[model samples]
Target: MTAHQNGNISAEVSDFLLNCFARSPGWQLWLSLPLSLFLLLAMGANTTLLITIWLEASLHEPMYYLLSIITLLDLVLCLTVIPKVLAIFWFDLRSISFFACFLQMYIMNCFYAMESCTFMIMAYDLYVAICHPLRYTSIITEQFVIKAVIFILARNVLPILPIPILSAQLHYCGRNAIENCICTNMSVSRLSSDDVTINRLYQFIGGWIMLGSDLILIFLSYTFILRAVLKLKAEGAVAKALSTCGSHFILLLFFSTILLVFVFTLVAKKKVSSDVTVLLNVLHHVIPAALNPIIYGVRTQEIKQGIQRLFMKGW
Candidate 1:
């Protein structure tokens, strides 16, 4: 009946019971309210942004195209993780089939990596616009966008395909309880009866490579952008240049900070409570998704005008 003894006999785990915020069951119902609100806001804001972009011909430029990709990724990421979390909170439905769990894990990993890569691309776009203004149009043309999209999809999806496959091959045995909201590779792999060294190592190494490189490139892009902006002799040029990148920097900072906090909390697990870690992990997904469209809508004038036009037409 014990976990190890059960594991010794069988290697197949049909389903998994997610241990989603089990410590404070009383607060879960109340917690679901805000989480549900975040999900609703993320879906609504991103959808409106997408629709506005689609309907407005003026917004068909390369920058908006990249924004559209970000919007779609946010929508997909939110859809992948939030509904199941809501179900766990509201109905106490935490059981997920082995296959479904792996699928969710795959989607989460792939979309998150895609989102990070997209942010790097967006930073590069900003750099080219600010640093190499003359070449911006020619460099970031439709063809270039198409190529970048292909790279994003291939780079993120291909490497992540093996994650779920490797996880599926593991001997899960009777340890079916996962100690988090989503079906992350680490969380599920921890339940395996077989050695999880490879899984842990892969996740650690892959995450650092993907996210680390993107962050470094994004930082370098902004560095050059800052250098270019500083060279302007015009009086208001600095403010104008900063304003253009303000929203992007804000969102990027929030995105990176929350992720860093989650990683640090995981490292300092003894100092942090499980509930706090779980809350951080859950919020990192939805909070960015909810705020991204709103930031771009309010900060970017083109998007604002597009929204107005969309509403006027609707009326």
Candidate 2:
């Protein structure tokens, strides 16, 4: 098996070297410091949030249970992508084996969909709590959350499992360098000698169908919540409702906006620098994970008190 002329890439290439920030070697150190900080913050904050919810028996409701699910997802997302990125930055360990890359791709693809679905159902929980106060207990019971968890798992895993399988089947004759820090479906598939039209179509169409539907459902849930909040007759009731929903709303905004920007830039790649595109993709995983617990902690009183109780017990 002779090496190809272009960079001498072999037909038997077994690993991919991530060309992260390849255009700006000087910036890798600069990026590494902040990335490391964010990873640490995300890990600490999410762990504390999970612990707070777990130990404080009072916090064990459908709402907190759902929050726990998202927190765990955030932790998993960070652990999956960030440490490997940090290795690339600090230790120059950019080579990811074919098996690991696809496994990472599968987790990356599947978890995000699960997170979106979780956010949609969470919005529904808020709606039921505010709109139908009397039936909230029955509608948003532990049983209801268990069912939602099952739905989230099934909805994402079955559809996304094919992504890596299809990607792995492509014949990579040469050019095994992935320009991004992560093993995105497109980044890996584009390296193949085979026609990747099916991969592109499945990724684009399937991703939109999953995320777009969740966004639409989330929008409707919040619309009803807003209407219900406005009709409240009690003084400060509106403020209280806004206060209750504000953190979740902020989280949703950051989640959706970052994802939208990444998708847009990814499609219109010519307009954006490749480094900028990769940077956004990296931050999309870290920024939201770091901020979700902090926003909820700052705005939600119950969470704030739970943290305090945990700290007091530790002290």
Candidate 3:
């Protein structure tokens, strides 16, 4: 009955929602297939990473020690949601149960925060090892990392619980189809007719604070690391330092992009083309998860040899 700007009658919110959900394009097939390939590869690579890191005592040193922990976290993180996320493309579950979506949101957010904390710890570890090599043993001890790891374990899960918990209380009397495949908090929020002011504010503030803090710390750490790497006169020593930090740098950038872009995009209402959305999800999860193992394996030669040794011995 109401006329719209284009001389068309204004459609109900529900109709718009249906259009967004149903308009998945043909090119999504391309996105979904490759993502599945990468996901499977990530699973296997992460398994090897876990086994190899635990088997070698040489890897138990402070530097490799932090690296091993990251491998484990990456495995847990990727496996926790990417499988279900991929499942959405195949299953036409246009609507997700409220509880299920909240659970997914909680899990995804928890890992996102955990990775942020991990990055900060990693930057500090490198700052000490490279910047203060003489005191590396004393400064970056096993005890220091253990405490930080414990704190991160507790801290990451604690903050995100609020958002999902609050969301579970909202009633949905209407449309529930998720536009994109995954069950992100934004999708759940869109379903609610009640005031989402609190949830939106929390997401914007909490998400940015976590991502900004980690990134700032990483920048500062690298500043000091670069200064130290430059002071080293030996080409061989400089190469070694660069090699170690280089992989971590690349991996950090990869993870940061995936986590930040996905979280930040929640506010945008424009329906992402199915292909683009799937591609975003794939690169966000698959490539980062797969690239992580490669970064660790290639940069740390010992890991490659250790994994080979492990396979040979098992045989």
**CA RMSD of each candidate after superposition:** 2.6, 1.9, 5.7
Candidate 2 ranges beyond 4 A from true positions: 1-7
1-315 per-residue lDDT for model 3 (tens digits):
222222233232221111123465554455568868888888888888877778877777766767766777777667765676555557633344445667777877887788778888888988888998898888888898798889888887788888888766665544445566566666667766778888878876898888788999999999999998999998699888988788889989888786556644553436544545444654676678888888888777888899889899992
| Consecutive 10-residue window with the lowest summed lDDT within model 1 | 1-10
State every prediction's TM-score relative to the real structure: 0.95, 0.96, 0.86
Clashing pairs in 1: none
Better of 2 and 3 by lDDT: 2
Instruction: Tell me the spans in candidate 1 whose CA falls farther than 4 Å from its real position.
Output: 1-11
Cα shift from native, residue 96, model 3 (Å): 3.5
Compose the digit string of candidate 1's lDDT tens values, residues 18-78. 8787676776788899999999999999999999998899999989999999899888888
Candidate-wise lDDT, in order: 0.86, 0.88, 0.71
What lDDT score goes with residue 39 in model 1? 98
What ranking of all candidate models by TM-score puts the best one first? 2, 1, 3
